[model samples]
Target: MTAKLEKTLGAVSLWGIAVGLVISGEYFGWSYGWGISGTLGFLVTTIIVAAMYTCFIFSFTELTTAIPHAGGPFAYSRRAFGEKGGLIAGLATLIEFVFAPPAIAMAIGAYLNVQYPDLDPKIAAVGAYIVFMTLNILGVKLAAMFELCVTILAVIELLVFMGVVAPGFAISNFVANGWAGSNEFSFGTLSAIFAAIPFAIWFFLAIEGAAMAAEEAKDPQRTIPKAYIAGILTLVVLALGVMIFAGGAGDWSKLSGINDPLPQAMKMVVGHNSNWLHMLVWIGLFGLIASFHGIILGYSRQFFALSRAGYLPKSLSTLSRFKTPHRAILAGGVIGIIAIFSDGVVNLQGMSLTAAMITIAVFGAIVMYIMSMLSLFKLRRSEPNLNRTYRAPFYPIVPGIALVLAVLCLIAMVWFNQVITLIFLAMMFVGYVYFSMTKHQRENAEEDLMLVGDNH
Candidate 1:
């Protein structure tokens, strides 16, 4: 028998969970942008991406509140464009959640390698997935509370990282070849900025993950918007703070391509293998773990939602004794573990496994953003009588900004990582074909299961 989920999460917990979902972005992912465009150039990318997220979160909140479901964008697009549309959206989300964790896991491995060179990074990464997935399977509230606590620790470490690096900061260092050694206003510099979009968007990539928890929140209509807004604001502050301070403290280019940027920044300030740097190497992983765990929660919910709604196997939707989506969590974890070990085989064109995966994940996120915004515009005109607890501020304008920027980013990814973009499209095509053939039978089964009302 499947257990029912409890609605025990409150506003504060919701905010924490939301922040936890993407806090690691501040820690490591954004540094890759500096590799492409240097400090000033990446800053341009960050500002534009920040603007995109601001519009996206506001518009996303309205749709999430009006129809609070664990499916997140999948649920919204499903309502607006029917089952096939929903399947596409759901697959995109699955890509976002599933692919993201492997990147985080790879980052985790790189961090551990920095601290204890003897530890095989891949083994440690697989261990992390094993430990965290077990915690996720045990219970949702426990997992959420754990996420909140680790997120707080991560936030504190980021502040401490800033303090340690601040005294050494120099404006000249930040601007040194700031456009990645390109001539001023040249096509090379412009091209670098466009290529930096994925890394910039990584700064707040999964802030939308919070909305996926709506089904388990207390009074989601009120709690969902509050969490989304507060969460985005918090991330913007952290992203800029860390980026500017770290960029100013060092050459910026040296740490640009690494998975563990903060520790490298500390090394520049304090000296080689400084105790302070070594300490951060261990503690900084809390930041990665926060996102690692939180994203697991997100992907599990997405898997459960699709399964329960006839988009995937009905068996995957069944809750455990603790009322958590255990099977969903397990399934995603297994795929992630495979991705980590098989990283050697998953390369696209000339991109490294980590870069290819990150770009592919961004591809999924951008698609969902574009579709979700379209769904918001469609529903507003077609479903005038629908109850909406919160309206997106700025109406079509907010979603319009997000949609345009997302499309631009998509264009950027195609130009920069064409092979991975093509690979992502192939994945979508395969998934759509499978979903279309099985959906009707699955839908009827799902409706019947809903009537069963399983508990304990």
Candidate 2:
């Protein structure tokens, strides 16, 4: 018998997981947008991306509620377009979920290194993988409870950050060189805005990851819509608030390149020695930990779901005594840990490892988003009679907007980051090769089962 995941998540827990999966964005990664597009330009990129997410989530909820599958996008695509489409969506999602954690984990290490300057960030990153993977392996309920606690603290800390920095915020500082490559909008500024797409995406990248938890959610059809809608609203408010406040607090350019922009921005307002700065560092960790821990859970579930369906080795589908996919959890951790160590050695398009990883993850996410929206549209026509507790408001228009924005983001990313785009394509090619090789085996197994049934 297949070992199944326990349903212990309520709307609140699902919301926590949704928000927590991407909260690290508020703390870091996104400042890189400021680097490429400046404040105003990146703001435009963010607004576009935010709109995409808002629409995507609303439409995505329909599929999540209807299917209530752990495979998330993979399951949706499989039902809509069959095994090949499932392979594409599953691989894209796996890449997104697996690659995102290392980038977040590295940021976690960077946050810790602020307090203990002597400690190596990579070691701390590996430690995080070990700790969170263990927590997830123990049980989903325990992992989600911890995620909720940290997510709440992280949200509060971000509010405090905005409050404390509000007084120091200056319109002049924020708008200074607000457009990348020029003070005024031009062709260059347009290029910069497009270049900033991935970082802008960083703000709300994994919000759709909530769908992965549908199989484990209590009254998922009802609870998931609530959790998803609320989660996106919360993230948009926080992302806008944090970015605007952080930019205006000081010379936004100075904060653009670093991983721990929140703490650095706070120091400009509160002074390096102030208690508020210290609190931001310690409390700020909750935000990073929340994302790091939550994404671990998300990726492991994807692994388990894929493996259980024979997309991966079946060993990964085996649940621990605690009713968790321990092997899957460990498998993703091993990948993330390997990525953490590959930091300086592997550079894509002259970008730092963290930036490259973020870009790669965004690449996966965009592909998955495109596939998911297509799946949504296909199912709407193909299975019109399918029960949907929550239909996407505005139908074609809503999902159409999401599909357009996702394709645009992909175009911008591929345009600006050619090398990383190739790398991403290479990864997909490899996954496809594996899938093709395994397809005949799966078909044979099915035929054998049919034969046995005939004899019986």
List all candidate RMSDs to the true structure: 3.2, 3.2
Model 2 per-residue lDDT tens digits across residues 336-451: 88998888887778887788889999999999999999999988887787779999999899999999999999999999999998899999999888887786544532222111
lDDT (Cα, 0-100) at 20 in candidate 2:
97
- What is candidate 1's TM-score against the reference? 0.95
Enumerate residue pairs that collide in model 2.
none
For residues 148-191, write the lDDT of model 1, one tens digit per residue: 89998998888898898999999888888888665365678888
453 in model 1: Cα distance from truth in Å? 20
Candidate with maximal TM-score: 2
Off by over 4 Å in 2: 444-456
**Candidate 1 — which pairs collide?**
none
